[model samples]
Target: MISRLLLFGATGDLAGRFLLPALARLSADGRVPDGLQVVGSAHQDWDDRTFRSHVATRLQQHAGDVPIEARDALISRLRYRAVDLEAAGSVAAAVGAFDDGGDAVDRPAVAVYLALPPVLFPAVLGALGGADLPVGSRIAVEKPFGTDLTSAVALNELLTRVTGGVEEAAFRVDHFLGMPKVQALLDRHAPGRPLTPVWNSASIAQVDVLWEETLGLGGRADFYDRTGAVRDVMQNHMLQVLTLVAMEPPARQTEGELHAAKLELLRSVRVCSAAEVPFRTRRARYAAGTLAEPGATGGRAVPGYSDEDGVDPARGTETYAELLLELDTPRWTGTRFVLRTGKALGTARKGVALHFRTAAPACDPGDAERVAADRLWIELDAPLESRQPGVQVTAPGERAAYGQVLTDLLSGGSRLSVSGEEAEQAWRIVDPVLQAWARNAVPLLEYPAGGAGPPPLEQTAGSARG
Candidate 1:
């Protein structure tokens, strides 16, 4: 029922670039309601008119060489307010104009978006708790839901306590849930489909959720140093992706329906055995080096993660991490989950590779090279696949079986995708991982920049070749 979108951190990195323009494009397409109100908030002291200019700059940055029209029209929808997020009345200040009880058809409720840091969540919620808002007032929380399991649980409890309820009134999001390809993954694995029961079955040799980033910590070095790639990418992002790839088929297909399916997968996931987990997880810290430009220049010298603006000097934090996982359920007794992520990779892309058992035994001494493992790319994020026809058999990695599932989810909603509850469950699965890391969970596994993960991972990855 929320009609107005009050975007927190509206002037910051995300809003200044993607979110705002997405909303603008939606408006231009006439998809948004006529009275759809877009509000922006920040700690900087600025009037609405002044804030409008700040947002425009971000859009231009994302626009790149693409042409944009009627910039003012999109700008007209933006409203900004200066707020001290930590102060007592910050929530009320950010919740700019309000609409009294109005007809449902004429006006809708408020949608407050929390785009700032997790620490500020409590303050903002406290402010809203004291404010006089209606029952249907919905609020959104961003990623890195909590630093660790304890923090995540506390944050969830805090939001529920502050809001007095955590039902439809609160919404948690992962942009991947909005992708097209993700929806297809759901569609691919339905009740009677080959993908569902086979999702976790040994039928699949293994599943790899790969998240790669070309840019290292750079400006976020300090933040990246502490969180590392595990917390940054694998924990939240890939966890959700894995949930979809391995979960059971739900009775229904709505977000709520999908949530139930995902929860079962989380509950079934076998905790990585101490030995399997310890060495299975890999971390690499990118050192200063020059990277090849491919077609442009010979190469560019990029500072290692430690050189990032805000990163700690002696940080052993990894910009890249990989983990091997499995589920205890009957479906996937021995199937493994390989999670790999890095900031200083050669490219930027996010997707899952499902290496399936095309043959019964999975081994052929006669023609191991000729035999192929059907690997499908459930592209929830990037690095799409293309298989132009009339071509002969291609290698397992080179085949066009690459799919664009995530792309399908975006530009709209995807059924088998994660909802607030699913996202929370995914968080719960990582609770132990987070606690382990917070308490120096495992000895740090460090690797050089522009390379693969830690040296120990080479041994850990012995069984993950699938």
Candidate 2:
């Protein structure tokens, strides 16, 4: 059981939209342990009652479906303190409250969660290093670990130094990995299966990993403008999903074994050279257009990417990105993996699809010579949904992605956490594309707000799979 949870950005969008709702669900399901105290710290000036009122309001807005008893119980454990996280003395004071009677042995295991922006990670960690933390304390950090490879390395080094070089004590969260559908895919693809034998270039023609959202930037223009689609989605979430789909089966399902397998797969990923990037990747920004809904009288008009509030027209931010990558490993030499994501799309298509090679032509005179390749699609429309082998499976006790992440954090599991090495390798794989785009080596195309992405690539026997 996690004795205490110190939330650094308790008043941020992430906290209100995701973290608090997840904690409420855990409470409703009896997953959170009894007597778990939660402390909220932020730069905002608010007392306990004000903070509780804020939590109550946000809880109703985001998690209205949760039971009143669960919400009330969660609120009862919450307390607030406003602190400048950069100030060592302020952080120390907030952390010192964990001590009930100044008895070191009696203190509970504390988990510090940093929900702030990535730029402030180092300052927060530095302050925590000076604070008198309890034994068995863990630190959980949200995604976009760093902007690039160099910063990611520096952040990892700082985390290790502060946490006494105990890698397991640092949790790098990626909620996509915690989705039950992802776990279900891992469970279905265990050893000794018909598909397992054909999970290679010899039998598979191509793979597509896509995440398209119909909604545009809600109110995050400042963040989204700086970090475009590639860094925002491809580097962390999409790469992690690709690793899962392409990784070799783990020796066992333990966290260590699974992470090792994923790390190895990432290490084998090949980035396009500067000269090859133009042909292998595509970037586009959405223009103003109408988004048609089924049975609606009229379509809803949406603004262009450049027209979004707080967005600079000169930045050339992309709303849609697609990259064609190849794995250098012998097992996947000839196969291609397409990674794509976009906002303000016509439809929300999110999942991984594996297209296998077609069978040889039939011998019968009347039979068709060629047929569509067989596909094994794993749908990840939402947290609890799962579809495998064309059949939907609803497993009991399925939890939301954020809830699973919390369960792992409180229970000392790192399966959903990305390691330092994995973070660096992911950046390495995309750094070239980033550089190319900055130099304007590749053209930035424009597409309507609601439309299928750039016309599908000419369908070769190989490209027909996606």
Candidate 3:
């Protein structure tokens, strides 16, 4: 049982909404051990009192909305420390409060929740190490583990140097990976599933990840510029979604083993061969566009990438990217992993759609080949199946029910939740793709933001290169 929850960024976006309520729920449910202490750490020059006050405000904004009285009780457990990232040994010193009385925690079970930028990870890990957290301490890490493969490898190497090679203790969260349907896909649709037959080359034709955001980079423009949709979407989140949908099951269902097997699958992913990579990259920079928010007008003047400060306006930095990807794994060797992501879209969505090839005519010589096929859409937004008009139909045609995996994973930390190893492997596979973009002036198809990605994607059979 974790008694002390060390929050690295008390005032950050994630800590305010996600962590606060999550911890409040944990506290309310008694998952947190007694004498529970919440340590808020950041470079915010707030002293103990100011930091505690900040915590109270956060509670009001988050946990205090419903339980005002209980908010005080939970707020009482929170302590703010003015810890500097540059100051050595500050982490050890900041976390010392939980150990006010010797052995108060019995065993050091601290969850070091990191809400800082990805770059600060190594330094923070070092500070926490100096804190000398006892065994059973778990560290939570956010996405973009690395902007690319080399960066990811370097980060993992740095982590190993600090922890001296501890495995599975790191909670690398993609948030999307924590969904219940993702777990169900792993458990039910694995290699031996009855549905496996349809997902194979002879039956299934394509799979795609649709992750579109309705809002542009309001203040996060700088961060968004450096790591476009490639690192943000394809390299990490969507690839994790892709692998789960495409990878062959391991001999057994263990996290480490499964991830290692996934690494093998990704390694087989051809790195350089241009044809294998394809010329289907579509990227867009949003101009001032109308947001679909409740009160938006014809064009409410939302800022685009170029409008943001501290960014090169000439750079073709993509706010939207779409790639018709192909995997080397035998299960989905020929099928396309159609990926699409963009900022300033009309709607916010993140999910995968499985488009199955329609079955061939059985015995009727008169039956013509079908153009549009059936699809299984797993979505985060509104859940509905796609349907078309039928002849003489009394009611609308049957539509498939889109499922929500987010709600399931949020309530329970299922294993299908993207593991750190899987995140790293994803970076490993896409490293070549990024390098290809840099080394060669590959043509980039331009699509306006706030629209469907660069026209529709097209792929040719047996055209893949080594």
Candidate 4:
């Protein structure tokens, strides 16, 4: 078991809003080791006491479900270190004290999680490479693995070198994989299952993987302005969900087998050529308008994308993105997989909707609705529902996705982490659209901040719906 967790970017928004709360949940459930130590390292000048104070406040704010005792236990295990992450010697000296002193078999496992920006991965990883961590130590990195294909491959190479050439020793996290509902969706598609019969192109018309948000860039203009819609969710989270929906069931049903299957599926996805990019993709930015609150007739005013603080109007980044992708594989040849995401939309919708071809004409004239195409909607942030008969699964109410990620990190397992090849392939799948959008091969369109996203592309019209 991993007895020590070394967290980078410990004082960042991610740590406060998600990671620390997750740790508290794990502590409450007795999922973490009793003697586990948490070492938070950042550029902040805070001492151990100050860091703990911050953690306590975060727990109070974000982890209200956790008992006070568990919150205290998690806070008790925390220690703080101020380090210059770019300096190999400084990083080594700060984290070295946590190394267990004993025979290799008796030493406790240590896991390092980089919760910082992807831009810092190279330098921080280089520092860790020089730190000479314990042989069995594991490392986990947060998402947006890279800005593009080239950088992703380079980062993968760096991670391999840092972890003694063992690929699985480094975990590339995509928290969507940790959602219990998402896992349940994958489980349903196992070979010989009920869904197996209708899972392919011949039976399914389209698969729409969507993640729309009503909220605007809430002080994330620095990051959001750079990432936009595609890189922010489409490339990582949405693609991962699509893979689980589209990949063939592996023979062994193990992590390695599943990884290979997903990689194969990703590779089979036909990348948009320069000319095809404009026809298959759409990009848009949100304009100033009113955003409706959930279930309410009223709405609040929202600023346009370019007007958001820290935004660069010259960048022409899209707040909305849509891609009409197809796989060349036999099983999914004709079926379209629509990947769409947007911010400042009228409503928040997060789920995968599979539109199956209509089965047959209705026996009763009035039963046309029931005989229409079947849409199996696997909801990620809400309850799962299916238009046809199918199992509906919900995530565990007690734990969040981050808690599952922490569990996987502590277990030293690659089952829930993205592999290097997977990361590279994901980049390959989206890079062309990015390139085309950059050179204005595809015009950047606009829509009201709280309206449905920009008008659907001609190719994607009538296929994608909330």
Candidate 5:
């Protein structure tokens, strides 16, 4: 167990909304040891008392459900320091203040959680490069790992060097995978399961991993304009969902086995070529319109995507992105995986849907059998109202997605964390599409908010710029 946690960016939005709340829940459950210490470092100049007060306010706002005593217990463990991320010495000094025990064998483990922005990863890792992190120490990093494949590779290499070539010490966190539903999906396809046998090309025809939302960018224009939809959703979150749905069942549920299976599946994803890009991908931005309320006729008006606050009209950044990907492995040779995400959609539908091949109906003398294709929907956002049975799973009561992530991180497990190679392979699969869209090789369509997204690929492919 980790005896101490060094939480970077403790005053940031992520820490207040997710990390602190998660830790508070664990504290409530008595999973947090009384002797455990938490060190919070950020640019804020607040002292320990002031930081605890701030934490109290944030916990009330975001984790009101957690008992007051638990919240207080967590706050009691927190100490604050103002550390300069850009300066390696400053970071090293702040972290170095927390001393490990006498020897490596008796030392209590210390874990570092980087809740800061991706741009600060290199600097923080560089600082830790010189800091004396005790043996068995771990580092948990947030996502948007890199802007592209090259950057991801470099970041991985830097992390490896920082940890003295121990890849397991660096945990690349993807909170989406920490959701109980996603974890259940992984367990659902374990060896000997009924679903495992039919989860392949022979039975399943196509898999759709979609993340559609009715909410527009909520004051994140500075980040959204640069990231757009593809990088924001598809490249990491959606691809991870795809791997969980389609990867071959691991020999066992061990972390190494699961990691190997996911990595192999990601490696099998065929990267789109220049020629295939046009027809295989689609991009669009939402136009000005009213967004309908859930299960109601009334709605609120929304501005067009490009007119949103802080967006660059000239960047041609897409608010909606779609990609049709294929795998070269025999298990999925003929199957397709469609990944899509959009903002300000008519409805919020986030989940993986598996479409199974239509089975031939029995011959009847006078009646003709009309059999529709079977679909198993693993609903994430809401329950579906389809004739076919759908599966909806939520995080085990009171445990949010980040809670599960922290559980794995603190326990020194990598099953829920993304590996370095997995991150690079995801970029490789989507890089071609991003490049094609950048060069204007693919046409950008306009779809109204509160309506269906851009037209199908076949309808727009002919109009793609040459």
Candidate 6:
């Protein structure tokens, strides 16, 4: 089927940095079908020529070294229209122009991609419902689906209204799931493997899903201030990773099977109670400090979170957040799943680490020395470098995360997309933590900009119960 992608917020930073560049790479690789058209829409009043020029510039800047022929091929299929996405008639008018005289059966399948803010999703979806698009047309939404559980449920309701209750047609894009290494990790969890055998509370000690960035909030101060580290990362990306690790093996690898398994896993998630929130969660804002390297001469100095240009000190936003969660299932009851993310750290570390429990000591007295638990690391930022002690799985020719996501959407695949239920459940899991932070029940600790996060939480005997 011919696919036409309608990108809302076409002129925004996300489109320029990720969506358009990904499309360009797809065009270069000949993954985008010949008949597929890309139509960009925004509030900017630009004609087709001007819009094409803008796309060309962004592609050159972000895509990097696209062949001339491939670049032109993608640019040729590009079209643009100016529309106030929230207005009643705006979406209908834009879609109406693309309508062919032929019957709906003969026309291309339209996919409306909402790249706008989460706040505008309801209006855009409502406008699309009024536009009377094809019955089978798809809808793709960006991340941070909603601010909280209530809003997420409302967003899902809005999506159902537009898609006529067809949940599969709605695609909520979470770019982290599209990473090849993440897919590799899922493959390892299939039936009958070394890791699969120990994938339970009995064998595993703890699971850490960490995403740390050395760079501070560069120019995204306004958005970052409102959406601290938790909402921006833990709610969607980190939770999705947790589900993948803790979920039961799907009957098959199909999108439906995987999604169902993930939903079931999320349903079993147990968040800390109000009293336990303080001990189970930690939030910290970075303070101005120098990043001291072990061997390097002088460390790099950085500004604190409060020192950032657009940040508000009074808002008490945290640049770093850590939460301890548990799956209330028999397989993972005692296993602590720690989700951590921070900015302006000493180093950049992005991956999922599964730390296995050390076996019982041998009878020999010489073997009394404690042996560290085996660790399985999935290094996301580094390409083709996922490794255990002796085993390493290299994912060759891994495509860009956004590029893979675009490919999935264009081909009518939802495996990498977040379902409506998943989005809501993620917010539900973190709702209590958010409320606790709001009430100042959990103290917002301060850490040096380039230090190793806040002090570790005291672990009680037996296991670290959060």
Q: Best TM-score goes to which candidate?
A: 4
- Among the numbered candidates, top lDDT falls to 4
Which digits, one per residue and each the tens of the lDDT, describe model 4 over residues 274-328?
A: 8688778899999999876533446667788888889998999998999989898
The window of 10 residues in a row where model 2 has the poorest summed lDDT is 385-394
Clashes of 5: 0
Models ranked on lDDT: 4, 5, 2, 6, 3, 1
Which candidate would rank higher by TM-score, 3 or 4? Answer: 4
- What lDDT tens digits, residue by residue, belong to model 5 across residues 175-194? 88877667777765566655
Per-residue alpha-carbon lDDT of candidate 1 for residues 1-466, written as tens digits (9 for 90 to 100): 2357787788776565456656555554555555666778887888987888776776565443223653556688777777788775766756646555554334455677777776688778778777655555666676677776567777777667766774555555555555555545666666665445556555777777888765555466535666777777676768877877777767777656777777778777756544454556655567776554444354556776666677775656767767777787777777878778876655556677677777423222311122244766655544432232211221222111111111112223334233545555665566565455545656654444455445434355675433
Per-candidate Cα lDDT values, in order, are 0.61, 0.80, 0.61, 0.82, 0.81, 0.80
TM-score of every candidate relative to the true structure: 0.82, 0.90, 0.81, 0.91, 0.89, 0.89
**What are the per-model C-alpha RMSD values against the true structure?**
7.3, 6.0, 7.9, 5.7, 5.9, 6.0
Q: Candidate 4: where is the Cα deviation over 4 Å?
A: 100-107, 294-297, 359-373, 383-399, 458-466
Model 2, 353-457: lDDT tens per residue?
777786422222321122344665667654232222212222222237888888888888898899999999999998898889889987888888878767533
For candidate 1, the per-residue lDDT at 270 reads 59
lDDT of 1 at 421: 52
Give the per-residue lDDT digits (tens) of candidate 6, residues 1-466.
Answer: 4378889999998898788888888888878876887889999999999999998898887666778778788889989989988797988877765787666566667888888877788888899988878656889998888889998998889889888898878989998888866766666667865456777888777888988876567678878898899999999989998888889888788888899989999999987789888888889999998754444457557688899798899999988988888888988988888888998777777787777776522222321122343666667656332222212222322337888888888788898799888898898899999999999999999998778878755342223362
Runs in model 6 lying further than 4 Å from the true structure: 102-106, 291-300, 359-373, 383-399, 458-466
Clash number for every model? 24, 0, 0, 0, 0, 0
